[model samples]
Target: MGAEVITVSTDTQFVHLAWHRDEKMLEKVRYPMGADPTGDVSMLFGVYDENTGLDLRGTFIINPQGTILNSEVNFYNMGRNIDELMRKFKANLHLSKHENEGCPAKWKEEGDKTLKPSPDLVGRVYEALQ
Candidate 1:
């Protein structure tokens, strides 16, 4: 929960301001809407499209040490799932403390079952989930 969120795009600050002012979806967003018209930030993240002059939808969760814990990239028209994003963020946080466990795709919360990766866990994930 101690993470900062900044949504970056190729749009200018004025464009972000107008969208926040006029769009119902962005009206409640209080985080910084970063303007990357030159695509520097997007290029750094490997989401910039040189042909279209736009960035694909990308989400990244970075730890305090500046390591990227998770990255998800999608096409521009594809909307992202906040629930899944939250799940991945929570799993990353949990994994930071419980270094021996791996969160499966279905892992949703702290109390959810996690797996200990070993040779024995290779072919028995289905049984372990049960």
Candidate 2:
């Protein structure tokens, strides 16, 4: 997901953020990341809070194609497992390479086992793991 760029914000519409109380101050910001309010982008990923109208804390694993692969929308005060998300994203990439193989829980690229839905060579995987 890092290979691709990721952006998280709290504005649902550009206009909503554009009408900030400090219009002049916010206008000075160059990037949307700096000015987008109401969190439309955040809502797209189900992280924006409707009540408070702010970007909820979230972690989204977006693919290079601009598609969301995984998401974790929790809270700004709470913490997320960035390392684990990276591992999962890598494992998903690995499985995609071999579309026929199915990755199990906690799968990784190198030594993890992948099932092909048939008995071709299960023992071989065990040996590889060792």
Candidate 3:
């Protein structure tokens, strides 16, 4: 779980402060909240909506080597699932350590059995899963 999380918004710094202070929406947030009123970051991430002057929900997981491991974009109304994100993160970490293995659906932890890609696995995934 050695990861850094930062959130970027099109709102100004004052707006972010107000939301954190008055609205108390982000009062408990411990990570940095970057204000990108100019939409530079949003544009870079391709989440900015030019017409609406807003950003869609975008989540990116970048590895330590500056490589993007996962990228997901959703409509403004759609919320993200942190648990699923954590699962994917763990799987990525596991794969980085075990390059010969593959994580299957519902693989959650370090000790979870991973799939070994092979011709024998073809047409027998259900049996392999069991």
Candidate 4:
């Protein structure tokens, strides 16, 4: 994946610095941790919680063209899965080159079978996967 990763939160920049300095899990982190104290960036992404004055956990995969390829928002306690994100990233990349094709739920990598949407595919997806 040749994509840039940036994590944004409502915390201040100093808080991000402190986390990077002391958090064991982020010891080797190289990506930027954005501080959105005013929640403006989070609001733009529709992840801001007005009642809580915080941001919900959100992950967005935006392409170079500024179009969001994938968006996922979860509660504060719920975390995300890297495997599924990777799958979506791969699917988007594959679909960009094959606009007429559709990646099924089981599609994981290149060369995996894809569906060609049509009236004939209405109830034949199970057969197509086989």
Candidate 5:
């Protein structure tokens, strides 16, 4: 899980990017992420809160071709769901490998049957929820 971590700050004139050779901060992260001073990337993603001048603490799953597959920017009283994010990533990757279907809400791998997007199916799901 040697994923790269980066932060966007509006303090310096340029972006900041650094790494931690030591793995003291978190597990599975041998290197710590760096930050960009200007926060260009954050601005582009609309995660840069102008009032606070800080990123909204979001995560993005980008594909190999540099396409953003999923993104969410939320800070106050909200945080990204690790399990859902991982599930989405895995589902997308699986779709790339095989001709599978999408994931429904609270969907776990081989967990439950997914409903298709249709009027009848929607009514059934609504009834089930009720």
Candidate 6:
């Protein structure tokens, strides 16, 4: 929750400002909106479509140490799920604190059971999950 959230677009700074000023659009968005008119950042993230000259939906979760924990890119028409992003962020935070355990599918909270990597877990993953 302490992490900084930034949205980068291929639009110019003026366009970003206009959008922020639009009450019907982004009036309540207090986070920084980066304007990448040249698509430099989008290109760097491989979200820029060369043919369309538009950036696909790209979301990156970077840690405080500048390490990217998660990267997801989707088509322009597809929208992102903030709830899933928050879930992954929490899971990453948990993994950072507990290096020995692995968060399994559908793991939601800190108290959720984690998997310990071992030879026994290889063939009995369904059993261990139970």
For candidate 2, which ten residues in a row score worst on lDDT? Answer: 27-36
User: Candidate 3 on 11-102: residue-level lDDT in tens?
Assistant: 88888777878866666788888998889999999999998888999999899999988899999999999899999989999999999998
Give the alpha-carbon lDDT of every model: 0.96, 0.64, 0.89, 0.94, 0.61, 0.88
Quote each prediction's TM-score.
Answer: 0.98, 0.60, 0.90, 0.95, 0.63, 0.89
Q: What is the C-alpha RMSD of each candidate to the true structure, in Å?
A: 0.6, 7.3, 1.6, 1.1, 4.9, 1.7
**Over 4 Å off, model 3:** 23-25
Query: lDDT score of model 2?
Result: 0.64
Which residue pairs clash in candidate 3? none
Colliding pairs, model 5: 15-37, 16-35, 16-36, 16-37, 18-34
Q: What is the clash count for each candidate, in the order shown? A: 0, 9, 0, 0, 5, 0
RMSD of 3: 1.6
* Candidate 4 off by > 4 Å: none
Q: Which ten residues in a row have the lowest lDDT in candidate 3?
A: 18-27
Query: Which candidate, 2 or 4, has the higher lDDT?
Result: 4
Pairs clashing in candidate 2?
Answer: 10-38, 10-39, 11-37, 11-38, 11-39, 11-40, 12-38, 12-39, 12-40
After best superposition, candidate 3 residue 45: deviation in angstroms? 1.6
Candidate 3: residue 96 Cα off by (Å) = 1.3
Residue-by-residue lDDT tens digits, candidate 5, 9-75: 4545322222232334444543434465567877888788778777777778777777887787777
Q: On a 0 to 100 scale, what is the lDDT of residue 58 in model 6? A: 96
- Candidate 3 is scored at a TM of 0.90
Q: TM-score: which candidate is best?
A: 1
Q: Give me the displacement of residue 29 in model 4, in angstroms.
A: 1.8
Best of the two (2, 4) by TM-score: 4
Report the C-alpha lDDT of model 2 over 1-130, residue by residue, as the tens digit. Answer: 3364335465444644556545775565443343346566566677777888877677776666777777777776876675787777887687657778776665766567766645655556554434
Evaluate model 4: give its lDDT: 0.94
